[model samples]
Target: MKSRMHKGVSLILGLGTACTIGLSSLEPASALPWQQLIFNGVQLLQLSNISPQQTVALGQNIHQQVKQNYRLDSNSKTNAYVNRVGQRLAKASNCSQIPFRFYVVRDSSINAFATTGGYVYVHTGLLNAVDNEDQLASVIGHEIAHICNNDLINKLKQTQLAQGAASLAGLDQSAVTAIAYQLAVDLPNSREAEFNADDKGLQYMRRAGYNPKAMPAFLRKLVRQSSAPSFLSSHPATQERISVIERKIANGR
Candidate 1:
């Protein structure tokens, strides 16, 4: 009877030890860090963990596409002027570690866009429309804020994960991909992001020795221009944004 009791106790001890070891092994490896679990049990990529090399490659790819599709002036004077202003604003941005390159598109459209890879493109019409360096800096600062916030990547990944969830729910891969692509391309930022960008852009302009109020002034001009049935009609010039900018300027002091 004593022997049997001892045997049973040993067996229990051994099983407990084995279970503990198994659980330890089941834990995910530290090297392959787990990301935030989202819908459909899909994990989103941690943007901070993303490699710089990958970002550069992505930016370069987008830059090539923009170059191919848009009409950019190759003139040295225009390029130099744009680069000078961009460099100044980029230095004041939160993501100054990333190298920034600016280009002036020859198109007359009043459009400006920033890509994930630290590339900022400004249309000739935008430059022509601005009155001074402060106005230009405000535009650049706003665009740089988008880059600093990693808004593009976040939107892209959010879209991909959403589609992935749909795919797991019996949606075809092609359909999911199509939807994801469209969402990624047309990801309008949230109101919070827009306001944050406006505030940050104001600070950036101030840091670069330009008047922060220039942002609100330029925005007002854009809002007025939007009403004229021009190419600038497609932009976000809602009164809310104007009000936000005005409030920031009012409280900034």
Candidate 2:
């Protein structure tokens, strides 16, 4: 019993770390350096325990939490526009076999995130920031890649044993809620994950008939701003990512 409790605590702490990195809107002027965050993420990745069924269940829980915690914009036209672009990219993605859903959070903070299963979220701030449909598609495509690749499931696999143990013990739903909130809103992806999303998303966009260069163009815009939005701050774009995307674009990939 003591050992299980310890494992549960450790799982929560790991999720806490994810939440802190994710809430860039509340970030201090001197946020933890990117190197440290990446190192910490790599450590968290060491724990995998979730399965396909669990992944879906976990994603549904997080999606509900997001809707409850965040105010969703109710404009039908805006929602339709986002869904249209998201559907296009989803159809073009290799993971198109899975159903995808997208929603616009009412917040003005420029950001986007994806959770387990095929859930993708876009912030109203992000929609307002982009210049055109292609740029919008770029961002949506990135989130879709995260789902398609099962990145969250891969990460949660690290905590498989702990989560299973907790469930068997019938831990309170609040604990799951807390962890789901962090996963949905606080955890940031690793550098490799970010790049992978970018690459896959770019492919999806191109296949969907959008200009691939729109990705780098949007990313470049995000990196250049003196005060980076939550997306750039949380994702922390690096020169390497930009360079890789540029190279891919130049090579006509």
Candidate 3:
């Protein structure tokens, strides 16, 4: 398949892992192709050069790093609410077949971010910033759009771990940390990726029954906030994002 990797997704989140023995050792049934495998009752995919099993393994490994560094919010009610909203948007997304997972970080920063393998993190401050669930959906949807479009995977392809790093086998931890840091704190999405995620995320929220205006509204709010969240610092300019999203909404996208 032709790669559709784009530049409209935010690259912010923790990703690391040292375990891949389990995933790499599994052998597909004789009746099935090597690219297809059933694990823990989930069907894996092999989109582009990365297999779905590798994707999940990569996600789990990074999740371990995130767990080590961040306190995951355990408020069942709050976490459940975020997951519910996320699932709704996932169902409306183009890559709905991918099992999307959402988690809440205990940090007070008004931000949300995603990494490869359908993992998305929403900060506690972000939960407090949104006026309603629709706005929250917009944020989550944008992150999901990034994963669906394989934006981060493309980023990995350009990094030192460019060759089969998704397998998480024999990968250098220090290198992974460096790449993750660059993604989270240094690398901003290309202007095209920002616009594409905004447009796709807006559509996702709206298709999932949210007000289409919520996306741009939330972006505008971020732009005007006295203490703009780190999210703005790492994404395309908020004003430019707002303009593009508003134009798309006005044009009936």
**Tell me, what's the RMSD of every candidate?**
17.1, 11.0, 9.7
- Rank ordering of all candidates by lDDT, starting from the highest: 2, 3, 1
Task: Please identify model 2 stretches exceeding 4 Å from their true place.
Answer: 1-11, 15-54, 161-174
Task: Indicate the residue-level lDDT of 177 in model 3.
Answer: 41
Tell me the tens digit of each residue's lDDT in model 3 across 32-71.
3323333443333223466655666566666666776678
Angstrom error of the Cα, residue 189, model 1: value is: 2.9
Q: lDDT per model, in order?
A: 0.61, 0.70, 0.68
Name the regions of candidate 1 deviating beyond 4 angstroms: 1-48, 165-187, 226-237
Question: For model 1, how does the per-residue alpha-carbon lDDT over 10-124 read when each residue is reduced to its tens digit?
Answer: 3322332232111111123222222222335433333434545555555665565555467788989888988898899989888888888898989775666676658788888
